[model samples]
Target: MGPSSQSATVTASLDQLETVAAQLFPAWLPGAEGIATTAGGGLAAVRSLAIAHAAGTAQYSPFLVDLAVGALAGAGPNTRRHPPEMRAAGLARVIAAALGRPGCALLLRPPDDLDENEALALVRAAQWLVDHGRLAVWISSGSPAPGDLLPEAGIARPAGTTAAGRPGPKVHSTVRGTVRCGRTTDDHYPGERQPGKSRRAGRHGKPHPASRTETLLEAALATRPWAVGRAWNHTLSPGPLVNPVRVDLLWKRERCVVELDGDDHRSAGKYADDRQRDVLLQLDGYAVLRFTNAQVHDDIENVLALLQQFLATRRRTRKGH
Candidate 1:
C-alpha cells in the first residue's frame, strides 16, 4: 500500500478500536469500586487492557499493570523473605500513585510463569487492595488464570466482544506506553519521557515516533505563518503555590492553549481534573481550546481551521488590550 493509504488504514483501525473500547470498558469496569476478572487471554487481554488504560469512561479510571517488572515482580525467590502483606502494601502504593483518584481500576497482567504460591499471593494482595483501598481490580486472563486463585465473588466475567484481527502498528505500539509497572519518586511512571525533553527525542536520544494525531496536526500547523512560536508539551505554572501544568500545544504570546484529549478524559475523575486545569489557565488569562483525539484523527482540516480562527482572534484581542 502507498504511504497515504497506509496512514488512512491506521486511522480507521484506531477509530474502530476506540468504538470497541467505549462499549467494552463500561461492562468490564461496571462502577468506581470492586475486583473482578475479565474473559479472554493473549492479545485479547492485552487489547482490552490497552483500551481501558487509554480510553477510560465516566465512572472509572483504569490502569494496566504488568507483574513481570519492578517491585511487583519481586514476589520471586529473591524477595520471598518479605511477607505477602508487605508486598501487597507496596503494590497498593504503586496503584495509588498511578490512578491517584477514587473509582480506580487496575487491569493486572500476571507473569506467564506464575506458580501456585505466587498466584495465591497476588490473589491476597488484590483482595487487600479492594478492601482497604476501595480499588476495583480486574486480573486479565493469562497463563495461570486469575479465576482459579480468586474467590468466586471477586470474579467479574463480563461478556463483550473486542476488535478482531491485529491492530495497526501505531495501536500495537501504544501497549508498552499504556502499561505501568511502577512509579519513580518524582511521581512519573517508569519509562515515561520527562518534560523539557525535545518532542523529537525518545529514550537514548533516538528520534521519537510521533502519534498519528500529533504528526497530522504538526504538518497542518507548519504551513501556517501564524502558527509559528507555538510550543508542544510546554509546562506553565499559573502561580508559585499551584503545581505547573503541561499543555499539548501552546502559543505563549497569544496566551492560547490547545489540548488534545484521549478517551480517558471522558472519565468522571479525568473530566473534573481537566476542568480544574482549565480554570487555572483561565485565571492566568489564557484561553483553552480542547479537542478529542478522535476529533483530530477524523477531521484535521476542521481542527486546523478552528485553531487558526481562535489564534487570530486571540492576537487581535491581546493587541486591543
Candidate 2:
C-alpha cells in the first residue's frame, strides 16, 4: 500500500525512496503538507515506494500494501465507503496480501445487512486496529471480515492509555492509511457525528457487567437512527457475568436494547434473573429489545426495521403522554 516497513533499514530505505519521490511522498507526510516542495512530490513518493516495493530493493511489508490500497480507499474512482468490497477486488496481489486476515477484520462486526460494502470493511478494519495492533489492510474490491475468521491471529492492541485517560487514538501508525475511531465509538473527535449526542447517559464508562444490558440500552438510545449500524469494542467492565453483552445497536431513536442473548440469558436458571432485570429496565421507562444469535443472522433487516417502527411509535406515545 504505502510504505514498506518490512524491508531492511525500513526507515533509511523509506528515506531514500522519499528523496527520490521528494515531490511526491513527502507532501502529505505532515511536515510536508502546506510547506513548499519540489514538483511531482506526491507522484514521486508513490512511485519511489511502488518501485522499491515492486523490486526486492525494498522489503514488501503489509504496511506498504495497506498504504497503497488505502490511497484507493479515499481517492480514485474506485475508492469506497465500504472497504471489504475494495479488499475483495481482484487487483494487485499486494492489495490482496495487504487485505490479509486478522488485521483487516473486527472481533465483533455490525449487523449482516450492511449498506456500503467498502465502508463496512473499513469500519471492521478500523475496529480491529483499536482492539488489536494496527496492521496494514490492502485494497480489494469488496471482501470483508477476515478478523471474524481469524480472531486468534490479530495483533493485540498495545497496552497504554491516550491523553484522555482512555485508549488513545493512533494505536499504531501507518504510512498511508488514514485511521480513526469507528462510527460506533461513544466519543468522536471534532466534526465526527455523535448520534447519542444529546442523551447524557454518563457515556464515559462501558457497559456494566451485571448491568451490561442496562448500560448498553442507554448507549443504543443515543444511536437510535442507525442503531443497527452501531457496535461496542472497548471493555468498560469485567465481572462475574460470563460473556457479557458487549454492544447495543440502535435502529431508531427509541430506547431499545438489542443484546447478543447467549446461554446466560437463555438458560432456564438465568431466565428468572433476566426477566427480573427486564422488569427493572421497564420501570426505568426502557423498552429493552432482545435478539438471539439466530435473529441477527437470519432476519436482520426485518428485526431492525421492526425495532425502528416500534421505537417511533413509543416516542410518539411518550410525547403524547
User: Global lDDT of each model?
Assistant: 0.42, 0.32
Off by over 4 Å in 2: 1-253
Candidate 2 similarity to native, TM-score:
0.26
Worst 10 residues of 2 by lDDT: 172-181
Cα displacement (angstroms), candidate 2, residue 232, comes to: 5.1
TM-score per candidate, chains pooled: 0.37, 0.26
Model 1 residue runs over 4 Å out of place are 1-208
Q: Lowest summed-lDDT stretch of 10 residues in model 1?
A: 171-180
Best by TM-score: 1
Error of 1 at 255 (Å): 0.4
lDDT of 1 by residue, 149-242 (tens): 2222123222222235432211111111111111122322233333332222222211113444555677778899978877776778965556
Over 191-254, each residue of candidate 2 has an lDDT whose tens digit, in order, gives 3223323222323234433333334344544566544433332222212332343233432234
